[model samples]
Target: MPASDALEGIQACVFDAYGTLFDVHSAIGKHQHRLGGRADQISLLWRTKQLEYTWIRSLMGLHADFWKVTQDALDFALDRHGINDPELRADLMEAYLKLDCYPEVPEVLSMLKDGGFRLAILSNGTPAMLEAAVKNSNIEQFIEKNFSVEEVGIFKPDFRVYQIAVDGLGIRPEQIVFLSSNAWDAHGAAAFGFKVTWVNRFGQSKERLPGKPHFTIANLLELPNLLG
Candidate 1:
């Protein structure tokens, strides 16, 4: 639990889509039997490479939408694991579009919405990808906007990427409560000046980064209480 004084003057709640609100591993979980013993490893590698590609591409000035990056990452993971089935690859990619929300997501978002805070998602996902996931998870009404990196042609950790939330919400960075399950993303949002909360769902260690989160909570269930 966070100290009571941590979050203050929060006008909006901006969340990272994957891992924060949605279960990024749910796609792989659906095919666990088929993936067999390599399921966990492939999923982990896929996610790692997915984020790595985004950062690398951002630095190289060769931006691709998250969908493409996800596909490429899945390909790499599959190849590395010696699973070369085209049907399985396609199924995994399709599954990414409909990833499940974390069990407490809807309840937490509703609580925040009932509390009168504006809500939005600032994600590396494309508009289409975000839309499908939000709609699939039935959380569309809770989100006012889905801010994608496509608008800026860059992935996250980029200062410009964080600016989308500020610009879209028409608020100062300090007024927004940014939440992300990724430690690096929490640090990035913090560096960009948002009042950050690292939703440390997987118990990841805090990154040694320029910015530090004001609070760290195990899950979104702790969010409404913290904000209040």
Candidate 2:
């Protein structure tokens, strides 16, 4: 379907951080020389574990802040890959703090802001991480709010996590246009009543989840055209 079909009544725009806007793989990519051929494997494992930890922790009612979970996930990935350099682990964690936003992020966000949409980032990232990333990406001016899962102590696919955006913006669920690169995230928000767009940058398969996104776009650059 054309992206423009999803723009009808979105009063605010909420985004997912790690993969949707920022390039999460860039952290591992920065140290490809140190990781050698294992760079891609490590990056994949790190993200897989990072997300799994959140879901597992949430299900078990065991809450660890995202930063801690991020490190723990990294440790598991490094161990699995048999790359045990303490400095490299620390460097990878540090690199995450400044992941690069997608090349189209700044301009698209500026366009959305100029169009008078309330823009926010609702992610599982810790406030410190979010702040640093936003500042480093130089898109802080385009964001009106940053809603971290820390507020609710849960991760995405959970209703409360999506509720953060609703509460933070003081808008009904249907009024928000929720965007995420994760298919499950888009489904979750859709189930919660947000008009969702799954930014399928990798062209991944559809999720076997409860809800479906109203639209799908390959990149943020397609977003502004959709909004109007």
Candidate 3:
């Protein structure tokens, strides 16, 4: 379907927390002055490893909370870049709790809520982590609930993780509209039967996966219109 098309029968809008609603790279961006030349590289690696660990742990059936995975990813990224400062490591971890939301997030969410759509977050982040990010960004009021993988002890792309929204929202998969900036995540939600929207905030290419998104938009600013 085209990006301008509206998704019918969507009772609730479920979002991917980390990259969708909140800016994951902002954690490292906040500390770029300390790293000098390696800021961008470290930020990219940290996010890569964070996501990699989630999939790996899910496969192994050895689930850890997202907070632990986040810390471990940061450790690996810091070690790889050959910058071993305990203070920097501690500061980066703390920065993650309050990562900035995309500039359009608040307005888009407010518009959607005003339009009478139910909103919630479905993410690999633990409840505490999701809570901190939402509250920190001051968008908590817009979200009705935050669904974490901790409930099922697995990460995204797993059918079970997506079911959390279906069960919690008391709606069929087709009735929920799932949004994610992560290509694989958008594909997974679509595979699970939701109308998926790939929020291509960074202009990334589409993923070669089993399911395709119904719509693709550059940012959440286009969301309300697409839903209507």
Say which candidate scores most in lDDT.
1
Give the runs in model 2 whose Cα sits over 4 Å from its true position: 1-6
In the range 77-150, model 3's lDDT, one tens digit per residue, is 99998888999999999999999999999999999999899999999999999999999999989999999999
Each candidate's TM vs. the true structure?
0.97, 0.97, 0.97
Could you tell me how far off, in angstroms, the CA of residue 174 lies in candidate 1 after the best superposition?
0.7
Q: Looking at model 1, how many pairs of residues clash?
A: 0
Candidate 1 lDDT, 29-132, residue by residue in tens: 99899999999999999999999999999999999999999999999999998888999999999999999999999999999999999999999999999999
lDDT score for candidate 3 against the true structure: 0.92
Residue 202 in model 2: lDDT: 99
What are the lDDT figures for the candidates, one per model?
0.93, 0.92, 0.92
Where does the lowest 10-residue lDDT sum fall in candidate 1? Answer: 1-10
Question: Model 3 residue 24 lDDT?
Answer: 95
List pairs with backbone clashes in candidate 1: none
Give model 3's TM-score versus the native structure.
0.97
Clashing residue pairs for model 3: none
